[model samples]
Target: MASRKSGKPASAKPAQPTAPKYLDAKRGVANWTQATEWLRVRGIEDIECITPDFAGVARGKMMPSSKFTSNTSLSLPSAVFRHTISGEYPEETGDFRYDPLDGDLKLVPDLSTLSVVPWETDPTAQVICDMVTTKGEPVSYTPRNVLKKVVELYTARGWKPVVAPEIEFYLVAQHEDPDYPLKPPRGRSGRTITGGQSYSIAGVNEFDELVDDIYDFSDKQGLEIDTLIHEEGPAQLEINLRHGDPVELADQVFMFKRTIREAALKHGMYATFMAKPMQQYAGSAMHIHQSVVDAKSGKNVFSKADGEPSEAFFHFIGGMQHYVPRALVMMAPYVNSYRRLTPDMACPVNNAWGYDNRTTAFRVPHSEPVARRVENRLPSSDANSYLALAASLACGYLGMVNGLVPSDPAYKTVNEGSVDLPRGLLEALSLLEGEPAFAEMFGQEFINTYVGVKRGEFETFMQVISPWEREFLLLNV
Candidate 1:
């Protein structure tokens, strides 16, 4: 396994076990007896029981396949919920959600996510888990649980939300030193990317081995990736996932990122989903295409019989316009994410909706009535996929429920540099802190804990002095 920041292989740490409460919570857990037998028959030795932390990083225990039985108990520290991106716990204050005892939470494995590790030398299988209390109640703050709750909102209304992600990332030379700058690695053509090559076929074929490996692993993991393309930035590529259930898509993305990173490692390169990994190039984005369909009729809810947009579509756009500004904390989760939000970067700067327009944050593509959908271009590649989709759908869900109407579309317009989006993580955090929708959609306790961790990160970042300061200010001032 590798640390998110360093991209270097990290030594495996032993799991510290907590006493299990021995409660049979079978709601999230599936019938794993057959799955366990399947793994055993395939000679799988290690089973990685994984869970996504607040930062969206995979963290969990690796146990022998033989140890995975009906009585298997997986418990982790409750403090894991409050861990920062750097894998450290910030000081707690006020009336915090977690008690001073720092008790354990049960991790129930999701049997459906079980798959073989294609890259690992050892025969290994991995399964995603959900965090739960001793009494079998879901931890509301968990990203997967939050998404499930939001999906229930649409389910209750006889509608189903669908999402497809266009995730952009960059391939760089593997650099061991954290301070060293990363450059593009040589592709199949024996040449490194030198300039922007948007939509260039040669650019994509340049790294044929890496691309092929990505597709291979994605298929092996049952990730239905639709397409891959050379994006605007040098060494940047975009992978579009097939549209499906929102929760399934989020789970795919969560695994896809790790799979890509591991594939890059095997190729002696590094793949980064960080929004602005390079100062000179455009930022990476995770643009999610969404639409709603009738649960029973299976008709597009955003379209009408005559092929025109419906009132629900307008309200959905209106909800996005009303709520996107406050949801920036989830869309652009890190300080680096803001660097990609500038007007000139081809990223959306406003919540304006438009028909077949890329400038607006909400873009309605030209599609048949059944395929009618809106593309939200605000979220960065660095965001947690589950939370981003949940926040986005929640906003639109509220709009449909409240009968809100959107403003005029910003059709074929350029960035006027007048949008009022928060320009930094700190500003976004402040907006989210005061917004009631955030508390309503994502639990109040979760919001408070997330804000606290982000605040600590921002404070820590402020204490550092960058090379730019020394280079420009050391002698001049």
Candidate 2:
């Protein structure tokens, strides 16, 4: 995969002295007063009030810092959640109807999420907001609220779920035409990457200047990146986030996507989170490593006093194996997402659980008793972070509560001819709608709306003619 000539690297900006103080204040800003003080101290000129829609796209308003007070009201149409990726709403969404008046939902900012927008030319801040109804009730169908609902379930049971997400994405050259395929961007060497460079330090150094900006931006935003490494595709990289609360981690992932894209653009490159951006190369994925802990004791529930795997561990796996097939639509939302699940692409096609085996959908990584956890490898980078984490945890929660049993761990390769998962977007949506358990956990209304949105996207995708059909089916069929 060759690319066009690289653009001149942008000069790094000087770090602000207030950046460290802003990062420290993010942890202690619990109310509007403290939030206002933090912004005032940082000399914030603008504030971005944003929330993640069903597609994980940032949707909300931007305002001058002086006008963004505690009493300031922000809203968006409820219909934003119903819109598909192609900006089209399905005319007929079964069992779910759009309000004729198109009601508005209030945006209540989560003050803890406030951080500096490091890449912005001016002193700007951003905060993630939660949507609520006119009556001050939470909108249960919203992605963030859905995740919060699941987290509350764990809280009710005196358990806390921890997650560490490893997000993989590709760096491609800037392209204008949608008809042309993406190619790896040229690095400092002024040469295009030709093949896979897994874990190659030299390969990573090719784009060291860009990576430095990513690190600097993340630091200013108070996002912690545990590690960064090259993956098995040309110009592909992965960043692992430190394990913490599910909702907090999801918020970080949501912000990190925008931060990465902004950082890439500064270097005249495009950072793509598409599941399968190029053919004949490994696809991007968002692998979630999760574990449950006792809320009071702060101990891993997956391990027993004897340092052996507990029943809860196996039950969690069992829950995933049973429900992930049905929850595929949440983890793999886009039509292009399915292209990454092929057997040859080093992606899991089945929900087989195993010990440190990448071929299985759920792998129990080798860790000390305190860190015993299961890694769910199904979610694509294109998935909504909030929904994907919610679905995964919900499944595990059901497993623990219902005492589900898992099959014996797979000792050999289980990637080949494993057709246990849905093969297409339509199939995945059907499976999701047919499963009542998900509807109960994620809410029936949310399920209906999600299925409707996905159906609309799939229908739109079907209307387009691909090159394969023009080449092979134009005359042969």
Candidate 3:
């Protein structure tokens, strides 16, 4: 049976990487015509076709409206988001499959999903779309479609997942030498430095000017940015955004990355959300905070009096703990991502939960009802926000239905024991492959296709040699 956790005998600490502006609760009118008017008024020349990338990001360039995008819907190659240009889904009879060799797919905006891109000239606006064929059903396995399906699941149950994101990244000088590899940051004069002061404002003086633009731009875009904080890596910063429904929250994350990257470029610097950019620094993560709310009453399903989450919260936490191993492949998509979960990287290496504990993979923050929720602290900033969120909802649903019960968390790091993430991408793939239960959970077709793409990616990575290789093996060989 699940039981309420007792307070640990320690001083209460504010949640790390805290950003309050993100927590300000408000909603916007999603009228497409209104947005279009906003764009036209700004003299936007043309909308380049808006299409979803393989990574679920909206990508395309723009021209004059008279020249392009004036047709309302543009054609894209369906092979774009598919794992390979070959367009195979695990190969029929173990052989690969390809699509209609012709690159003739359509991109029709949802209109309601349009949001202004702050940095773009002529004020180009982007709207996400649902990929379809001659018939109009959402694509069965598009990652965004997968997230939409999960959102429907919650809606059916009269519940919705409220979500917020905490994204961490590093700002660095662009490298000219591909042979040298990007060297990690050192605390140069006026450079941001890393210490464990997760939320100390003084730590942010290095980017005194840059952080201001991030704040101002987010404000103009009506982004629910809470605050930006100095993280535990020299030159790394974590920006927190306010919580909202799952899909919108993920959308905010997508936009948030764009904002930061654009702002960094304007200042002539580079920003990386790479999971483990440096072995010595804390790896970047796009941590998600979530809770369930009743659709009818608009009340928190996880809430108890004083904003404390209910017993259901424990079950949800338990479900996540159980599913971490199987879900790691999706959360940590890249082969190098596993490297970030090692000791001292800030991400928990294992499936575990704790109350008000930063060391645990899941943290229960010290907040009352509106703020009472669990923090999923594993995924790298490079994660496709939609897919990771779907994975999270699936796990939370598993916890709720199976009645998962969490146990006391380990306050300290566990390195020698099993309290760690899978050692390698291959191992994570095995966890996914070995689990028929999870395949059934996510649907076999989806699982099969996704695994095929990930495994293919690993095979591709294995073919490349690294600078670290020449350093150790050149003279030795």
User: Listing every candidate in turn, what is its Cα RMSD in Å to the true structure after a full C-alpha superposition?
Assistant: 12.2, 10.6, 13.2
C-alpha TM-score for every candidate: 0.91, 0.94, 0.84
Ten residues in sequence with the least summed lDDT for candidate 2:
1-10
Off by over 4 Å in 1: 1-30, 93-98
Local accuracy by lDDT, each model? 0.85, 0.91, 0.69
Clashing pairs in 2: none
lDDT of 3 by residue, 134-157 (tens): 466566566766777778877877
Compute the lDDT of residue 457 as modeled in candidate 2.
86
Ranking by lDDT: 2, 1, 3
Question: Scored by Cα lDDT, where does model 1 land?
Answer: 0.85
lDDT of 2 by residue, 1-477 (tens): 233354534554567655544335543377777777888888999999999988899999999988887488899999999998889998765676797889999999898898899999999999999999999999989999999999999999999999999999999999899888999999899999866699999889999998999999999888999999999899999999999999999999999999999999999999999999998898899999999999999999999999999999999999999988889889999989999999968899998999999999999999999999999999999999999999999989998999999989999999998567999999998898998787778999898888888888888999999989999999998
Q: Give the alpha carbon lDDT tens digit for every residue of 70-89 in model 1.
A: 56889988888787787667
Instruction: Tell me how far the alpha carbon of residue 353 in candidate 1 is from the true structure, in angstroms, after superposition.
Output: 1.3
Higher-scoring candidate on TM-score, 2 or 3: 2
Among all windows of 10 consecutive residues in model 1, the one with the lowest summed lDDT is: 20-29
